[model samples]
Target: MLTSLAIRNVVLIEALDLEFGAGLSVLTGETGAGKSILLDSLGLALGARADSGLVRAGETQASVVAAFEPPAGNTRAAALLADNGIEMEPGEPLLIRRTLKADGGSRAFVNDQPCSAALLRDLGGMLVEIHGQHDDRGLLNPRGHRALLDAYGRCDAAAVASAHAAWRAAAATLADARATVDNAARDRDYLTHAVEELSKFAPEPGEEEILAAERATMQKGARLSDDLAAVSDCLTGSDGGLAQLRQAARRLDRIAGEDAALAAVLEALDRAVVEAGEAEDRLAEAAEALSFDPARLDAIETRLFDLRGLARKHQVAPDDLAALRDEMAAKLAAIEGGEEHLAALEKDVAVKADAYRAAAQTLSAERQLAAGRLDAAVAGELAPLKLDAARFRTVVAALDEGQWSAQGTDRVEFEISTNPGAPFAPLAKIASGGELSRFILALKVALAERGGADTLIFDEIDRGVGGAVADAIGERLSRLAESNQILVVTHSPQVAARGAGHLLIAKSSDGTVTRTGVHALDAAERREEIARMLSGAEITAEARAQAERLLERV
Candidate 1:
């Protein structure tokens, strides 16, 4: 329910704060006394289009703050708040504030947190619905008719939505699988050739590094082999160093028995012969170890070059060639078996589509039944509001397959026929301004138990009717207020008397500037106001008496 509305510098309303209560509240004043200003201010706070002209004559800006206390079990508003990343505790008030500048710019805030105007408008629709002759956002919009019907019928569309989602997902999966198989089929020859080539060569990790090192060593040994052979010949032949040293040692040993000096010389010659013989053996071993076949070296170099060339061709390092080969083999296998896989996917998609169709059909049947009941209930309410000759209907028609959605493939609209035997047409096309308001009222009363926004504002709904009709309109408004907070901008004394709370809007000028003010009426003040409504400019004794009776009747 709307707890209070604070408006500042908005047109004729300079500064006004109005507190509202439960049940029906009526605002009454003479024409041009700024009753519309109050509604305009409320609309501004509820995210209506902002106009610079709405700012007071000398003010730089205008602002409105509307506070609401959502019912305990209302989750729609809470969910919206959460989706916007705003937190609000249960039973807490939801405050919506809007400011309009003279430059035609505006800002919106919810609970003091800045938000977008679009978000504020959406939240406003969930909290308050203003029904006037020109209202297009609520009941009058054909787009929202389906949701309203579902709410009225208490029908759940979750199963249909879930089934549709599953079907679409399956179809998407099938599409992706088909694309993969088609692409693979186009590349089948390339995959087959690559896999065969890799299997034959069988490149191993680290093989390139080992072969390159061996090649380098063989090249160096080939360069040094001639020098090693020359050194071996000097050490081992008859005139070589080893042979000459042994001959000197034998001569010295034969004279060693005759002199001590000769014996020392023989010992030195023997050590020299032993060292030269060891050197010759070492040179022979080095020659054997350095001998490598040129053919072996050529084979190692060829293998290394082949491995590097293959790595470059596949755009991979030599070490990764093995893994790439395995991957190609797997793709070839999938291509060979793709037909069976494609068949499985097609069957799954068919099953999902069938489930979705069944769910949508069931929901459509329930909506058709709901449409009949709704038409009857609205028809029953028409006669009391002076629309006795009119007929109202809820049209439930199937949409084309291309237009099908999670909402169950049906288009729902409210239609009416203004005269007896006239073909029913859409509400907007057939009814006049006054008849449209009444038709909306009838629909509201019939669907009252279903639930809507906490607050409902009706602007001059009783404008064209009076006597029993006005009384009937008041009675229904009173009934609707039993579950909703109703604020009616009315001129009818009967409707004014039905209000549990009354506010009087009056315009005043003090020599220079004119301004509008709203006053909450007490019991005596309410009676005088209603009497003024009945007698026009002058209050008469009879009008007061009639006003007393009107008040008592409520």
Candidate 2:
């Protein structure tokens, strides 16, 4: 149930804080005293669309916070909050806040932690349901009629949902397989040719990098050949370092043993001769390693171009050529064996479709039974709201095959007849403003526990009728309060007096600033307010006595 609402700098309301209790609460005042403003503020916190014009003239922003304490066993709201990662514990108050900027942008928060407006709307839906004079939801919206009937029937919605999903998934698979077969059949020749061509090249992953690196090295090798050859000639040709060292060695060997120092010089000359021969051998090997044939360069270039051309044709990188070839191979295989596979998929789809049909038919039968009961229940509530002659009907009709959905193959609508001889018509098309409210009240009272809402707000539900008719609407509201908290904005004194808690919306001005205020009424104050509502602008002894009798009767 909504526990509290606080508004700051909202249009006519400069600052306001209100604590709400359980059961039916009524808000009453003169027409322009800001009763609608109060509901609007609450709506803002309930994730309704925000407008900068709601801000007070001198304020830069308007803020509203609504705190809700969910019932002990109601975990739907808790689950949603948990899914969004908002911190909330069972039985703890869930505070929803919205701050509207004067510039037309607003921020929303859950328990003071910043969140998106969508999350607030989702959570608010579970916490409160607003039924205003213009509201046409609940039974009036045909989209929800089937589900409402299912709920009344105690049908397994989850099972139906699962069956429907299974059928859809199977159908999707069959469709995709058929599409693939159709496309592949059209391109069978091309796919087969591509597979054969790619198999001959048999491109391997990472081979492109290796080949590119080898080509780069050979290109550089060609540029360095002249310098390498010149170095080789300088180190190993006649009169080069190796030949000159050997000549010196031979001369030293002839003068060996002429003196001790001369013998040492001959030994060093012989060692230099051996070392020079080794250096010459190494230089020859280095020249051989640098050797490349000019024709080989052309061959390498041709191979590189062939690989690039194929990559371009396939719209893939050189490295992805191998992957593309494998994909084409699979497509060819699919064409070769497609008919058998498609038959198997078709069988699967048929099986799933049969299962779904059975479930939907079973559900439809139960809905038919539930419909009769729902109509009877609604009929019981109609007479009490002074609609004894009206008829409330829940129509469940078969839909065409193409109209089948996850819910079922049925079109459900709530239709009504205002007179005994008139034909039943769609509720929205046939009911007047006051008649609609009364009609909705009957439906709501019949299906009050459907959504398990924490709070139900009715803005001017008793719009067109008064006296006995007004009292009857008040009686139903009181009955609704037994299961959920209800708030009604009313001009009917009977409805106002039926409220367990009463609030008066009043407007005042302090010379410079005008503001709206809400005050909880005490017993004595309640009597005065009720008297004023009954007589208008003037309270007489008779009105006070009548208010007392109304209070006593309750």
Candidate 3:
């Protein structure tokens, strides 16, 4: 329940603090006595859009505070507060404060802890619902009707949502596979061409490095070929030392027996000739090893160029060409096997779709049943608010396949008929302002304990009705407060008289400044206020007696 409201420097309200209690409370005031200002202040605390014009004439800022205390056995408000990181002791009140600066900026706080405006709005929703002529939040939206109906019927919406999601997942997976097959079919010629081209001479890994090294050696050999030829000329050409060495050896051998010195010289010359001959053999081997092969170099360069060109064309390293060829071959193979794969996916989708359809059908049936019961309950309430001839209905209809969603296939809309023989139409389009308020009140009374929010505020719902009609509205409001707290702003004295607690809205001026004030009426104050409400500007004795009788009834 909304325990209290405080406003500071907002519009004509300089400073106002009022505490509230359980059950139905009424705020009564004369026209333009700042009754709307009180609601605006409460709305500010509830995260309504801020405006600089709300600030008092001389004030730099305006602020509003609303305190909510959950009813016994209700934890939704506390849970919401805790989820927003606002700490509260067990049974502690949740305080929401909103401050607007004159410069078009605003800040919000929950339980004195700074928070975003969004958080305040969300937490506020769990605590209070403010219904008025132009309001679209709360129970007005068609989107929430299904959930509310489900809540009223105790149906498992989660189960239906889960099934819907599973169906979508299966459909998405199947669609992706089908798209892949479609794209592969479109690129079939390209894939086949690529496979054929790569298969002819799939480049081997590391073969490029080996070929490159050989090419470098062949180039170096070409540079050294002339040097090698010069070396061969020095070692065994016409002017070489082999002939001289042989001649010296033979001369030494002939005089070897004449003296020991000649024999030693002959042995030395023979060893030198043998060593020189070995050197000549080694030079010949080196020349043959360094011999250049232009044809072999040309073949190697051609192979390397082809490999590099293929790598660039295919956007892969030479080493990866082999792997790419294998992958393309596999994709082509999958094209052959794709029909079977797609058939299996379609089967899975069918099974999932059937399962989802079953769940949705079950949910739809439940909604139909709940809707009937809801119509009856709300219908029972309408006559008391003086719409006895009105008809209320909940329409549940299936959407087209194109309109299918995770929320299932049914569209839920609230409809009403204002006359006995008229066809029912959309509530928003058919009902007058006063009639809509009564309809909303009836719906709320029917679903009082279904959706949460411990507090409900009606902004002059009894705007154009009085006497028995106003009395009926008061009775229903009082009945609704049995399960939820209710606050009504009214000019109806009958509605005011039915309040368990009363607050009077009055505007006073002190020459320079005018301010709005709210006062909690005591027993005597209540009598005078109710009489004023009944007798207008003059509170006559008959009006006072009537006010006493109204209080006695309470």
Candidate 4:
């Protein structure tokens, strides 16, 4: 329930603080008494769009705050506040505030923690629902209609659980079959190409590295061959280099008896010739062994390029190609096996879908029975609201084959006929403004203790109504408050007298500006206000007596 509302610098409301109590509270005032402004301020605090023009003329900003006292340990409210990062003090009320600047900038706060407007709106929905001529009709929402019907019939909990289980089973089977199909589609070409490529190359895990090392060695050998040939030419292939040295040594040996130093030099030159001859033979052998082969080099280059190209194509290193091939093989095997698995999955989905259809059919039958009762009840309520000849019906249409959904296969809509011989039509299309309000009231009364929260506000539902019809609307609203807090904004004296509490939305002036104000009325004050509403600017004794009597009867 809303415990308090505060406003500052919002339009004519410069500053206002109002507290509310439970049961049927009515806010009554004449037209243009700032009643709509008060509701608008409350709506803004509940996260409605902010308009810069709503700020007071001399003020730069406008602010509105609403405080609520949900039941202790309300898990949904606690979770919602926590999700918004709002702190809740022990035994303290939940505060939601909105600030709007003249520049069109706006900010929202939940328990003093800054938040986005969308988050505040979501939280506001859980706390209060303000229904008016333009407000979103919670009852008309198709998404919630079925649950509402079940709630009204007290049959929701079991039906919802069974339906959810059926849905989960069906969803699981569908997911499995779809996964199989996707895998087959994705892996078909990949497997075929991988198998074909790997069959030809058949690369080993470390073969590329070994081949690369061998290619380097061969290349080095080719480079060394040139140096080896040059050395061989110096030693043996060119002019008589070694032969000339040997001839000189032989001459020296003949003169050895004349010079001892010449004999020593001859012996050293002979040893040098022997060593040089051996070195030349070794160099020639090396040159022959290291001779370049174009064919072998071409083969090595082709293999290396092929390996590198395949690596790039597959986005892997040359060494990882073997691993990639193995992975592709595994995927191909899975796809091949998928056909059988897909068939099994289809069977499973069919079974679960049939089960869901069966449960939905059962739930639909129950709803049909409950709908008959609800239609009869609503029709009975219409007569007292001055539509004695009107007809009410609950239309439930079945889905065709292949048009199934998670929410079941029925479309429920309210239909009405305003005359005795007229055909029933959809409520939104056929009913007048006054007729719709009465229908909404009856439906709400029937579902009072059902799916809705603990608080329900009906804004001026008494519009375009007076006399006995207004009294009837008041009676129903009072009855609704038995299970949920009911708030009604009205201009009817009959409706005002019926409330457990009455609030007057009045405008006060201080010569320069007019501000909206709210006052809780005591019994005597309520009587005088109802008299004022009845007589309109004149509070006669007879009007006061009528107001008092109207309160006594209802």
Candidate 5:
């Protein structure tokens, strides 16, 4: 429930602090007494749109702070705070403050922690609902009717939502499967050809580098082999170095006995021949080692070229061709087995759809039963509000499959027939401004303890009606206040007299500056305020007596 509201430098309200209690608190004053300003200030604190015009004429900025004390059992507000990462102690008050500068800038805070205005607005919605003739945020919107009905009926909407989610998940899976299978079917021929080509070529990792290195060595060896052959011929020829050395050594051996010098010369010549022979043998071995068949080299070159060509065609490195081969083969296999997988997905989707339908039907049934009860309840309220002949209906109509949502497959709307023979039409179309307010009140009275904001403020709900009708409205409001905190802004003395607490909004001028003030009326003060409401500008003895009697009835 709203605990208090504080305003600073807002329009005519220089500074005002008003504390509230539970039950129906009424704010009453003459016209132009700044009642609207008070409401606007509260709206601003609740994250309504900020305007520079709201600032006092001489002030640079305006601010409002609204404090609320949530019930111990209310987890919705706690969950909302937790979601936004704002902390409040278990029993602490939730304070929302909003500041508007003259420069058209604004800021919002919850529990003095800076927060987005949107978050503050959301929290405000959970804590309070302000209704008036032009209200669109609450019961006026048809979109919220389903949730309202479910709340009223205690329906298992979560089950329907869960089932819908499952159905959507299954449907999405089926769609993806269908798309995959269709694409694969379109590329069936391409996949088959790719797999066959990659299989036949059978490239391996590191083969490219090995073949390249071997090709380089073989090319170099071809050049070296020619030079080696020439060297071998020179070493083995009849007049080559080894032959000539051997012949000279043989001649020197024959003359070696004649002189010691000739023996030394023969030994040196033999050693030279031996060294030459060893060189020739080493060269032959090297030539054999370096030797490579031209045909084998050609085959290596062809294999390298083919590997590069395939890699280019597939947009991959030659080493990756092996992995690509496996991928294409897997795709081909999936295509072959796609129909069976698609059938299974279809079955799952059907099962999920059936489940969703069952849950939605159950929810719809609950809503239907609740709607009947709601209509009867509202009908009971209509007679006292002077709409005895008007009919209220809760239309829970089924929607098309394409329009189905987590909210279920029904569209709920509150319709009314204002006359006996009139066809029921939408609330907005069937009721006059005064009638609409009464109808809204009737619906609210019926839905009082079911679910809604803990604090409900109705602005001028008893505007057009008076006398017994005003008293009836007051009685209903009192009844509503039994379960929820209610605030009413009214001119009707009967309505004003029924308040657990009363506030008088008044404007005063100190010659230069005019300001609006709100005073919480005491018992005697309330009598005078209500008397003024009954007697207009001047309070009379008769009005005072009537106000006293009205208070006694309450």
Candidate 6:
């Protein structure tokens, strides 16, 4: 239930603070008394869209705040707050504030802590529902119709929980199956190439790096092969160098007999000649091995190209291809054996679908029972509201094939007939403004305990109504207050008389500034306000006596 509302610098309202009680409260004034402005301020605090024009002429920003005292031990409120990352204990009061700047930017807060407008909207939805004169379409919506039926049936929580769980389970199974199928299709071609490449190379992890280094060294030496060959030829490869050295050594050895010094020199020359011959032979062998083979180079290029190409195709580096191949193989294996897994998933989906169908059917049956009672109750409310001929009907249609959803498959709508012998139509299309209000009142009255948020606000619910019909509407609102707080802005004296509290919306102009003000009415003040509503701008003794009798009768 709302505890208080405060508004600052909002259009005609410079500043205002209003406190609420736990029953039906009425706000009354002549037209243009800023009754709509009050509701708009509350809407702004509840996270409605803001416009910079709502700010007062001299003010840079407009602000509104609403405070709520959530019912003790209300699990729904506690869970909702917790889910939003708000820290509040059970039974604690919650405050929401919204501020808008002249530049059109806005900020929202929960419990004075910075929050998003979305969060405020979410919390506000749980705490208040504002129905205005233009809102006759709420009951016409098929989505809300089911909720109404559930509230009437008192099975909303259980039915919604079961359907949500079943839908999620089925959705999960379908998603997993779809991902498996997509992966198998993507990897179909790659799997064969991967297996072939791994088979041929049989390459150890570091084998490529070692082989690449050896190949580079050998190629570099091979590049200078022609120079090495020329050196070898000049030294001794089928050439005259070794022969000349041998002849010189022989001539020196023969001449050594003539001189002993000559013999020593011959011995040194012979050792040198032998060393040169050994050196030439080694050079010739090295020249022969230094030749390059184009065929080996081609093989190395082809192997590297295959690894790199495969890596590019798979969006991985060449070295990481090994891991990618293994992963692809695993996926292929899963797909190959997908039939067994797919069957399991299908079974699970079927089970959840059946569970959802059963729950929806059971809920539908209960709704049918509840619908009869609702129709009876609404029909009883019609005569007093001057619509004795009108008919209120809850229509339900089951889907041909069960549709799994958050709210189940049964399509529900509230239909009405405003005149005798007329065909029933959707409530939105059939009812007039006053008729809709009366119908809404009847619905609210019937499900007062089970329907709605902690606070319900009706802006001009008594529109297009007066006399006995107006009194009937007021009676229903009073009954609705037994379970939830209700606020009504009205022009009907009967409605104002029925309120446990009455507030007067009056506008007073001070020079250039016009401000709207609200004041809680005492007993005498209430009578005067009711008299004014009953008469007009002028209040008479007869109007006062009538207002007094109306109050007494209530």
- The candidate maximizing TM-score is 1
Q: Per-residue CA lDDT of candidate 5, range 259-281, in tens?
A: 99988888888889999999999
Model 4 stretches astray by more than 4 angstroms: 71-92, 157-330, 400-403, 421-426, 430-432
Cα lDDT for residue 430, candidate 1: 84
Worst 10 residues of 4 by lDDT: 155-164
Superposed model 5: Cα runs more than 4 Å off: 70-92, 112-120, 196-327, 430-434, 536-542
For model 1, residues 101-176, the per-residue Cα lDDT tens digits are 9999999999899999889888888888898878876777788889888988877899999998998899898898
Task: Report the lDDT tens digits of candidate 6 across residue range 398-514.
Answer: 766646466766777888888889998988777767667677777777765464577888877778768888888888898888888999988899999999999999999989889
Best by lDDT: 5
Question: What's the TM for model 1?
Answer: 0.79
The runs of at least 3 residues in candidate 3 whose Cα sits more than 4 Å from the true structure, single-residue gaps closed, are 69-95, 103-127, 185-333, 540-542
- Lowest lDDT sum, 10 consecutive residues, model 1, at 70-79
Relative to the true structure, candidate 1 has a C-alpha RMSD (angstroms) of 7.7
**Model 2 ranges off by over 4 Å:** 1-19, 30-129, 151-154, 216-299, 452-454, 462-472, 491-494, 506-517, 531-554
Give the alpha carbon lDDT tens digit for every residue of 329-372 in model 2: 88777788899998999999999889888988887888888889
Superposed on all Cα atoms, the candidates' RMSDs to the truth, in angstroms, are 7.7, 5.7, 8.8, 9.4, 8.0, 9.9
Comparison by TM-score, 4 against 5, better one: 5
How far out, in Å, is residue 347 in model 4?
A: 0.8
Write model 3 residue lDDT over 1-554, tens digit each, in one string: 78888899999999999999999999988899999999889988988888889999978999998887743355665566667677777777767889999987999988789998887777777678888887777777777777788788877767768887888888898888788778778888999999999888767889789899989888888998888777667657557787688888888788799999888888889998899899889878776776668999999999999999989999999888889889888778768788998899889889988888888898899999999999999989988888999999999999997887777888988888999899988777776677777888999888765875678899888988888999989888988889888999988888898899999999999999999999998999999999998998888999999999988997
Residue 299 CA displacement from its true place in model 4, Å: 22
What's the TM for model 4?
Answer: 0.71
* 3 or 5, greater by lDDT: 5
